[model samples]
Target chain A: MKNQELPSLNYVFLLKQTTLEQPFISIKMMIVQQILFVIISIVAFYLFAKKASEIRRNILLGRDEDLTDQSEKRWKNMVLLAFGQKKMFKKPIPAILHLFVYVGFVLINIEVLEILIDGVFGTHRALEAPLGSFYHFLIGFFEILAVLTLIAVISFLVRRNILKVKRLSMAELDGFPKRDANTILYIEVVLMSMLLIMNASEGAIMLQEGTGNGFLISTMLAPAIVGLSPESLHLIERICWWGHILGIYAFLNYLPYSKHFHILLAFPNAYYQRLTPQAEMRNMKDIQNEVLYMMQPELAPPPPADGSQPATSAFGAKDVKDLSWKNLMDAYACTECGRCTDACPANTTGKKLSPRKIMMATRDRLEEVGTNINQNKTFVEDGKTLLHDYISVEELRACTTCQACVEACPVSISPLDIIAQLRRNLVMEESNAPQEWNLMFSNIETNMAPWKFSPDERDAWIHS
Target chain B: MLEVKSMAEFMASGESPDVLFWVGCAGSFDQRAQKITKAFVQILNKVGVSFAILGKEEMCTGDPARRAGNEFLFQMMAYNNIQVLNGYNVKKIITTCPHCFNVIKNEYPALGGNYEVIHHTVFLQQLINDGKLVLKDGGAFKGTKITYHDSCYLGRGNGVYEAPREVLQALDVELVEMKSCRSKGLCCGAGGAQMFKEEEAGTTRVNFKRTDEAIETGANIIASNCPFCTTMLVDGVKNREKEEAIKVMDIAEMVALSLKDQ
Candidate 1:
């Protein structure tokens, strides 16, 4: 068998011959496999699209913000921050490991495309004839990446569970978050193993046919399976192929419900990132108008002839719907990596405010609102809000607005924006500020300073 | 005493100064911060750069009110200040407070107030770069171990980290850096209206944490740019009872002391 010319196409034909004794039966089996693959792919994509549109709808429920300016700058930000993973390099060790997994995930999807084509058309190694040796090189590179991905996934799992990284194990990640992170890691591990095993099994049979010399990493494992009966080897190969494809579909649907959604959303989040200086909190234009109207009564809009007062907009965000759409998108784009929490001055100093938790709670509440909208075809008041129900006054007050968390975020999600809005609602809408803050506000209003000093004495420093 | 002119005084004389020195509330009233104002003014005067203060016309930039969530008061104050500033045709302004610098430069524009706002450290750095202000070799700060504190508003807030450090570099001092400086620099616990109210309960104060990092560098002087950070670090030093040995001086004060005699 080793002495045969053994063209790559002949290898697939032989694979079919060994799997089914009769040609007619093998052709029938191929049709059945094709139909099964098509049905599964349709269902997986349908479910994914359904959840993804629902998420889109939920994000759009937020107040509109115009982040469309500077298209070139936004595109550059997306390329550098999202595609390049520039911020991740702040911690070099995990960054390198994560890069291996990230690059592997992207590159291996090309192999997935090949698998899809094969499953749909009932043809094996379809790209081999056209590209020839480059195809062999591609698979070999993918095989090496698969092994690296496996190592990275396992290291991540150990870091999360055994090593117990402080950020990963924080109380905010207690139940579903913890499980979601580990589950994603475990899924990657299984998926990469399936790919490796499938390649190895296929390489083993190809070696017998004298056509498998270039599957770099898989060729090593191919020998252990070389002694298996041809029937068993073909069955193993088919099962791994189906498992790898199905597992990918499962992962796709799971993304809408997991922190792993950042993989898809990070690009758009980076593009829509606030492009102002970090400490520049957005001005309240409505409040400015109100002050203007007060200063110049002629600027105020006249009352209706029916004597109804004009509807005033609410001061700041009290719930998810009040937040800007970008804020909601920021929530969904969070990777749950806890880098924000780790860098939070409030959280690091034993305060209740974790910027990561702010993003997470915003996401959770937004999801709940989305579910409510899904059930009633419109959001009904749930008698709870993000301000008081999800985030506490203590947590909101603890923020220094230091921009540490904002700077620390790898994906450019600003938890500070949401925090500022919520804090605005707390103070402006509810007048719920600390006694000292209230005193400070009053002094500023009356004395034109935070302290109880006379405006007459503002220049006293000059004479002194 | 230096005869500091006000914008009103400059206007009455039918002349506008080159810049308006925005003596913030802290610089005007806070006793300790007044020294920073005087030092900055002395630098401007020594450089023969004509500048006037808003003096009694200057109001709070409403930074504390806005950060503490009182946008109404902040806007009201902003409106009045913009009126005064615009009335004066103030094209360029300089200040020693980062909070004021951040608000007036970044936040005031939307309310119809725009100016070329420069933080005093950045202004001093410009003066040094332009050769208008020369530092004496082996000045008072020479041979001293000085660690520059990157104030939240001035450093990460506005990306003005290098100017203050550059000003420090010109002092012939050994400028040691804290463990986290520049973009990763820790807050002095005085931002976001934290100065006006008590900090939320925590294991330790943020300023103490920041001050400890500065102390860990074994620097005797913790040089800072923002007045709020100066007060916070001063208190942090006092809490550690290291006030006798350690000093928190503003960059302006350092520059004032290190200026070459005419």
Candidate 2:
């Protein structure tokens, strides 16, 4: 048993006829494993990650009202968000799990190089032999991590299942959405099981051959393959190699497009996370003051002249564009682990706000925006059509601003801020706040409190 | 030299307490919290620290209204509270409610209520550092593997996480980390006026979710800084009839327990 090696999404080359590359004639390895894997890998990795990327870009930038200008600060923010994951640690466990998965996924490059050179390029020892010592160590390490990740994810299932931590489970407490959570957990468990099983099955080969303390345990399996006919050994090697590669590929591709895409986005989001606190996200100074800022009704730089305004220039964000660059980055960083929902008092108490959903909405919207952008649509024009087109007014109002969502996010994405900004737009700019917000504003202005307690009643506590 | 102001007058004064103990409505009206405030005041007085109370001059810090979705009222209260803190020329302040602590330290600056606000636990830790009080140190309380609940305001809200535990250890209580402690500390549902309003329709209460963690410790007591936490944890104990005879108290109360005199 060596250290755990992570699943790397590299184009592995299955080369023919290295001194070590013996052809296998095993029918099971050739016919059954390889074909199903190709399809699964294709669907999971390429289709999902690409589709998710497209959808999120469009949702955030599809409109003429869009603001995905790729500024230096935004790029810096992306580095911070996509890399630092500052927001993710706000929640503890899920952050840790997601963090490992992310590192494991990124380091997949090591293996990808191996597969491309060895599997595809016809260099049997091309990849692994070169990084042999390092490779052996790395695979051993990721294998352990994969095992640990599987354990952690399993605990999440138990919490969602037996302990029944609310908001963590998507069920109506009816045991259905929970069933879905379990199913997802099962998928993860099965995938990892397949991955590790292939490694261990191969490891018997390596162990008999006798390699020690490296990541790629499969190297040891090379000797175990010695017992089998050359053809059989070759077939098993190919089967296991494809199993590992295709599993990783499917996971990567599935990541961006599916709920699980948080797997891919979580790390970068965490790494490039905001340096300031969630409570102070609005305090990050604004940069762009082009009249373009004013042209749009929402991001309008301060009003002109006497300030005897027909309508006041709004403070805070109006849409994803109106949000600070980091804020937009936060939307993209969500891992959808439901940590925020689990911590949310509102969600636990049966309120409409699901922090996970908020992230999903943002990602979905970003996708909408991305599609429009790829088509060369102006955010200003397309944004108008895309917004009320995708998201609803009711969805934005459900937030309590408890900062639970803010606090629970492992990557530290503030779905709450997004929700608040949405509320700000509806209230300040559009004059269409929920009745409570409208009353709240007036109440603060006149009575200085929301109780609507009469000014006389203010002193009900004292005889003064 | 405590300047007392009603919620009404406090709204207008625009003063700041040197260390504004931003008392919420419960601190003023709830007997248990009022006692905590008085003890808090007495502790400062014994330490020969100059201080002022928002006194009768203070009003609800708008936490209740704000948490209840009455943002309008919350702002007014916050503005009024900020005005009083400013009037006093106060910079460093403190509070017992995680809610009040959060509002002043984390949130107030956004609405013009800037000050160096700290939670009481952190402040108490400072006092200990300054040699303000002495613990009997009869040795750590044996057979009590106590776990402290990181009140949302003090822990998650402001990140003053280690101070309370230091105060606990100073009193010599064995501390065990809860399953949901520190960054992942479970909420007790006493924040944001959840103490006042209805518990937003759930299978269980937040306090119970958190308290169960404490109970699982097989510890007899749970310690915290905020009064709302005290109230909720006490309720949690009563409800579960936790076999360990677990009781909830403010960290100040814990220190008071170790004190020879008032």
Candidate 3:
């Protein structure tokens, strides 16, 4: 190594030197670059925060619900479902590949923290001295993870495009949904490549100086670039460094607009997952009260002193706003993996019902409502609701409510909840049920059974 | 003929039975389901377990009504049934219908009716576990191929997968499993009140698809735990003209036949 001194402002001379002792850039240029980095970061974060708050406000537009009970169990669910990826293990092949990308993406971001600090403070390898040999080991481990992530991403891209996996290539994913998936894969490829190239060029400079950091994968590629001039190598390193950081910032902001937002929302979604038995549908308390008032008049609350009639709440959800916040959050947290649709009995039998589409439609309608609020300061009726507008009556009617979709969701989303609610609206609000269901309902109302069999003969089975 | 007592008779005698045998609508009215009701009653009698049926007082539990999206009707039925149940001071219930078991156990509590509701498969497993019920060695079903079809309400609905299989194990029959069993078990297209109405347009019926899976197992008998599943699977088998080759029988009926002392 050369003398341990801060390099002076001779850019060409500094670039020609192959010593690891000096900072990558001179102090004056470092200060200028630091300011640029700060501005870019602030802008990126500001944009992300703005969109994030809008999404929060949109989610809150849903009807009030209390999912905060059982905090201990909720925390366990968050850890198991989000952190542990327990449900993803249902399918082992993709699960293993997904584990690679998920673990790699998360662990490699530790190196980003160093890049961030170096960007802000004009230092090179800020964690290197503090962490000592451990820093090299950490970078080497991250390099191995990066290579694994690369392989996973490539296979995922091929599965989505070339081989066209059935669940992924479904018609609901046509147009922007398809593009969003492909774009995410492409972004991962670019980010991982930029990181590798930056580390390789840096390793080449260190190799010439006999002070390599011994990053596992990149050091092997460093020799290919060793023949380049020192200045050229340094230029390549700086360009890749800037490219990688900028790409990360861009990806961060893009998350709120893409299905990849699940990366952020999955934790809260898991924490707020429904803890009830899948067999139990949420009771209609309003209907219960309505019956109570009629059955036992003593249990009914007295009328207002002023004699104004109480406003009757709507029977069930007809639009996104009528749904619970957890349901809306489920929409945003959906990975569009289509496991729910694949497991749906109606979909498997070739009915029009696709549970994945239910989530996507909910999200799309919610976005439209959010934009309406943005422009008009409040939602002015767009004369459209989530029920008949986005999802069809055929789709809603086909569901057996067997909870296969709920059981199949890796993220604890209950598309059945949304389906049941919409069906309630269709029946009670619009009286749009099939004639056979109408007969059955009336039979239960009158004869106390779904069929017209007399209650008198309920125990006649003993005679047989 | 076996003598069956009613809750009214027990009440008039100044005594309450040990458990209320809630014969659901299907068990009461559907001819095919009536056999399951009879088989379960036979087991209860053979074991000397005191049980009483509501008889004339029994009504629907509103499982289908609620699932069919008629909340008003469902609540009315549930309210009236709760009144009857609470009046009788019923403590525990055993039902041959998974739908009734699920609704009364899970959905009725909020309406102020709570009881320890046990499905018959689970009850039979308990009976066998306690040694109150014993299977004959090499009974009629011994070594017979029987594939148990999991009911949606019983299996994934309430996680009562093992009790049915355990009961089958007690029978000493070869319990073959379908490709999808337990938590991943497919529905028989009879849940969510789909039993009453026609299924919406699809390329194939849900029950037909499920029955094909069951038949593909090559089990001579497709054993079921729910009345609705039994009805749907039977229809599917009949549709494919495989009813003669593949028989759909409830677990209770299987147990009633294989009883050691029968």
Any residue pairs clashing in model 3, and if so which? none
Best by DockQ: 1
Per-residue lDDT, model 2, residue A89, is 64
Give the Cα error of residue B227 in candidate 3, in Å: 0.7
Per-residue lDDT over B1-262 for candidate 1, one digit per residue giving the tens place of the 0 to 100 score: 7769999899999999999899899999999999999998888889989999988888899998888888998999999999999999999999999999999999999889999999999999999999999999899998899999998898889998888888888998899999998888999988889898899998999988888998899999999988889999999999998998899999999999999998
Score candidate 2 by TM-score against the native: 0.65
The stretch of ten residues in a row with the least summed lDDT in candidate 3 chain B is B64-73
Q: Highest lDDT: give the candidate number.
A: 1
Tens-digit per-residue lDDT, A1-464, candidate 2: 12332221111222323323423533443444445645554566567666765645543442222234445665666555557665656656766876665565556446566664454334444646667577566777767666776877788777776886655646423343345446556766765665555565556545545654213533443444445543344456566667666655655554454555455555555544444444332421221223224334586746567868554334444545555555556665554567788777556655555777766666566656555566775543453521244445555554445466677665557776666656545544466654554564565456544435444444343322
Fraction of the reference Cα-Cα interface contacts (below 8 Å) that each candidate reproduces: 0.86, 0.11, 0.81
Candidate 1, position A152, lDDT: 92
Q: What Cα-based lDDT does every candidate model obtain?
A: 0.91, 0.59, 0.91
lDDT of 3 at A438: 94
lDDT of 1 by residue, A56-87 (tens): 99999998999999999999999999999999
**For residues B47-90, what per-residue lDDT tens digits would candidate 3 score against the true structure?**
98999999988999988877877788889899999999999999
DockQ of every candidate structure: 0.86, 0.14, 0.84
**Model 1 segments more than 4 A misplaced:** A1-20
Q: Estimate each model's TM-score.
A: 0.97, 0.65, 0.96
